[model samples]
Target: KEYNVAILGATGAVGTRLMQKLAESNIPVKSLKLLASKRSAGKKLKYRDDVLTVEEATPDSFDGVDLVLASAGGAVSKKLLPEAVKRGAVAVDNTSAFRMDPDVPLVVPEVNPDALENHHGIIANPNCSTIQMVVALEPIRKQFGLKQIIVSTYQAASGAGQSGLDELRDEAQEHLDGKKMDAHIFPVKGEKEHYPLAFNLLPQIDVFEKDGYTHEEWKMIHETKKIMLNDMNSGAIKVTATCVRVPVEICHGESVYFTVDDAKDASREKIQSILNDAPGVTLKDDPKKQLYPQPIDAAGKEDTYVGRVRPDQENDNAYNMWVVADNLLKGAALNTVEIGEELVKRDLI
Candidate 1:
């Protein structure tokens, strides 16, 4: 059956990618609508040979749209998502707005497909970093039972949206010419200070809170719990994250260390075996041949890449793995589209 789809924030990075994915998606589409802010309204976006004009998003945007893909910022999603739902469109939101809401389902189709079953008109796509890591770990979690997760991410500039990528490119040119690079985007643009992301690593991603953890780090910790269906009242899996903005251009890479609750001793070989055969994951852990997933290899791909699997030296139950995926695809666009596919398969849309 064909469905009418609307894309919120159609002019933005993730939003534009979502439109591209939908155009290439196997799901039958009867119509497609593109909605953005007033500044971007009337801008023409090409899909195959069809040129669609972007319109300002409003409550009426989703009038006859069966499915809405929202990649707008949190505030935009917060304001328009309910309106879309009210008009009978199921929204797959690529924003943090409703991820932690008790009623909204924070979903990664590969990790928690069942969560879609409980959607109340809106389903949240987890943070890009959180989404790829969980896709790799969920299979292990299901087979061995998770106890804790510690992740250090090497994230791409794309996670910060188009401006972040532009800033990185401009900074690189300035550095090559030995000129003073102007910082306007990296670290956090809205904050008081900005840092150069070229040939540098910034421990800060998003603004920092009084408690010391940046919002991005906190999103990983909290969103992981929510997507894993861990009860807040009960301390199930202890998750900690150190999110870093790296010099990479597209894919987000994570070094994940995790401990399982299983009492039996599970070897790294066993864990590797499960991931090698799992869906949505490609295992690339062969150190001898200098073969492992890299950001360049993973960029533009839909599957999460897993490699460097080994046991933690100190703890028998703990293991370390590296995960990578394109922040714009598996991390954002493809994930949102996958949710739409799941909804159709389950008759939720």
Candidate 2:
């Protein structure tokens, strides 16, 4: 059952984490190939106790690879994943290139693993923000029918990839030293303007579409519907989002407000009871002791942390809660690796 795996973008933020997760996972990997751009080729990265050299990736890089784990940019994914597929490699991609393609399955393993059954050659990992929210809510949706979801994400800089993380750290030290802080990556890179994310928040992540909602916001809105409504005709479920880039370094936090269909049985305690036993979720809501889910606590963790489960006073069917997870882990790398495991379990590879 061992398979030869190739990790595209093996040198970037999510790419490197993908290597680590694969090393620690139960999926049988017969060999690992690290593929990056020509500039990063020849660099060495560790997988378990062995060192592997990065190779310049071309369509031929996937020749013998049974599975491809990709976190390269959308362009790289769009260019390379199909080549891998043509070569008989199944790709689990972490970019937006194929997510919305109707034929591609946008999956969060815990929320929509069954969607893996529908993939042609590529199974997409949902956006990091959408991944955590759906993981926290899908259990609730199953227990008490979900009718609506409204989310405002406090996203991490890492969501922009490694460069964003580096920019945030440099800006923080410059601000503390009273030096001019530099801005090159936050909000959107290569845009006309940039902002320092040190001790500040930008209510934007990615470019603004003509509709005035940023691309990240739109991803949350649409991806939520796609993942949640996989087996059900719940496309009527209302989903809205306001995505913001916060000053955090690792975990992404979210304030979510949702309404359930079976209001007669849904309450604060009832919601808490459901989430407490939900898979890949941790309930951290004991407000009497000043306990709640925080980014610092969720960093590097695989579970989605939830707290502040309170029924909205004005609406009998509505409730509010907080959700957090390591965007790099569950949101990207860990989830991608999990999809590979599911493929093995289902004999899809």
Candidate 3:
């Protein structure tokens, strides 16, 4: 089956990657529509030897489109996602806008493609950090009932979009040349203060709420539960996160510690064996050879990589592992395409 597809925010980091993946995806495309802001309307992007022009997005953009892959931003998705649906397109949004909306399905194809069955014309892709974590954890959660998850994310600058990456690059060159460092991005662009994000750790990804946890941290906490169990207070699992923006250019890494509700049956070796065969996951643990997943190795890869498996000495039920994946691929773009493909596979579209 073929369909007309439109990509909102087609010129941004995730948006650009989404366009690239569409060319390689199995979903047949009758036509491709690229929508960006007014300033990016005339910009051209290449796909399968076709240099497609990006147009300004509006409610009418999705008029003839059967599918909408939105990566613009949270505010933009909140405003136009429903409009796209109203115009007869099922929007798979890569934002936090409708993730917790109750009506919209927060989905990760490999982890919860079933959530897409009852889509209200809009499906939200989980946060980049949350997406990779759950992809690595879903197998474990299924084999052994999950109890709690505590993850510390090493997020990439790309999570903030291309502007965040630009700032990191400029800061790095200036700092190395011993020039005065300029700070305008990272942490939060609109915040009262900005901090350097090169050769340094900010320990914060977004603005801090009254509770001291940043928005990025909260997304990981809430979105994980919603995608994994479809409920925040489902008591199915408890999740916590400390999101930090590192100087890395691409991909995100997480040091995750999880407690199994039934560890007796799912030991460390048992969990590792499950992950080895888990879908969308690539196990890379080999402690003797000092082998494990790394951001540099995971960047540009489509699969979520898991390694550094170990049992926590403090608790027999608790174990730790490292997870990594290209933030743009599995975390955002490729996952959106995967959802669209899944929908197509089931003739849901």
Candidate 4:
């Protein structure tokens, strides 16, 4: 069966990778449409040997599209994803826009492909940090039963989009040249303060809410539960996050501390063995050889790398792990494409 696919935000970082992943995917594609804003419209992008022109996205763009892979932004997704669905396209959105909406199913193909069956035309891709963390823990959760999760994320500059990557590069050169560094997009672009992310780490990703957690952190906490828990209202699994923007250009590194329900059966070796066999996960834990996943090694990869698995000294039921993945790939683009493939496999689209 062939499907017509449209990519919203086609010219952006995640959108660009979505196109690449789709080309590499097995989903039968009868047609491909690239949709972006007016500024990127008329521009051309290469798909294998075929050059596709970018069209300005509108309600009419989804007229015959069977599937839509979207990552434009929250506002863009909010504005157009419904239009796509109205026109009969099932959208896999890589944005925070429809994520928390009860009607929309937030899914990670590895953790919860079954969630795709409940989709009402829109499937939200979880936050990049949350995506990798859940993928690393899901196998453990399935085996030992998850109880809690506390994650500290070392997010990349690319999380802010292409402008953030450009800013990081320019700032690095400026700092080395002894010139005053200029900041415009890090630590939240809309915030009054913009700090250089070249040699510094910002504790904030999105705006802070009344509870003092940044919106990104809040998303991690709630989105984790939404994806992992059987009930959204269940406080069964506690999840908290501290999201920080690091100087890395790509890939996100996370130190995840978690506790399992089955303390008697959950051992470091047992967890490692389970992860090794889990789908979409690559186990890299070996402390003797000093082997573990690294951001550089995980960059551009699809699998979530898990390493440094150890039982917590204070709590037998608790454990710690290091997880890494390409934020643009597994976290955003690849996951979105995988969702599309799952839909095809299930005949859901």
**Count of backbone collisions within predicted model 4:** 0
Per-model lDDT: 0.90, 0.92, 0.90, 0.92
Candidate 1 vs candidate 4: which has greater lDDT? 4
Quality of model 3 by C-alpha lDDT = 0.90
Cα TM-score of candidate 2: 0.98
Model 4: per-residue Cα lDDT over 1-349, one tens digit each: 9999999999999999999999999899999999999999899999988999999999999999999999999999999999999999999999999898888889988888888888899999999999999899888888889888889999999998998999999999999999999998888888999999999999999999999999999888888888888455579998888999999999999999999996457788889999999998999988899999998899988899999999899986999999999999998999999989999999999
RMSD of 4: 1.0
Local accuracy of candidate 1 as per-residue lDDT tens digits, 265-295: 5888999999988999999999999889999
Q: Candidate 4, which segments miss by more than 4 Å at Cα?
A: none
Q: Which candidate model has the greater TM-score, 1 or 2? A: 2
C-alpha lDDT (0 to 100) for residue 152 of candidate 3: 98
TM-score of each: 0.97, 0.98, 0.98, 0.98
Query: Over the stretch 1-349, how does candidate 3's per-residue lDDT look in tens digits?
Result: 7999999999999998998899999999999999999999899899888999999999888898999999998899989888988888888999888888888999898888898888889988888999999999998888888899999999999989999999999999999999977999877889898889998999988788799999888888888888887895566788888988999999999999999985357677898899999999999999999889999999999999999988899887899999999999999999999999998998887
lDDT per residue (tens digit) for residues 71-110 in model 2: 9899999999999999999999999898888889998888
Candidate 1, TM-score vs. the true structure? 0.97
Model 3 TM-score, 2 decimals: 0.98
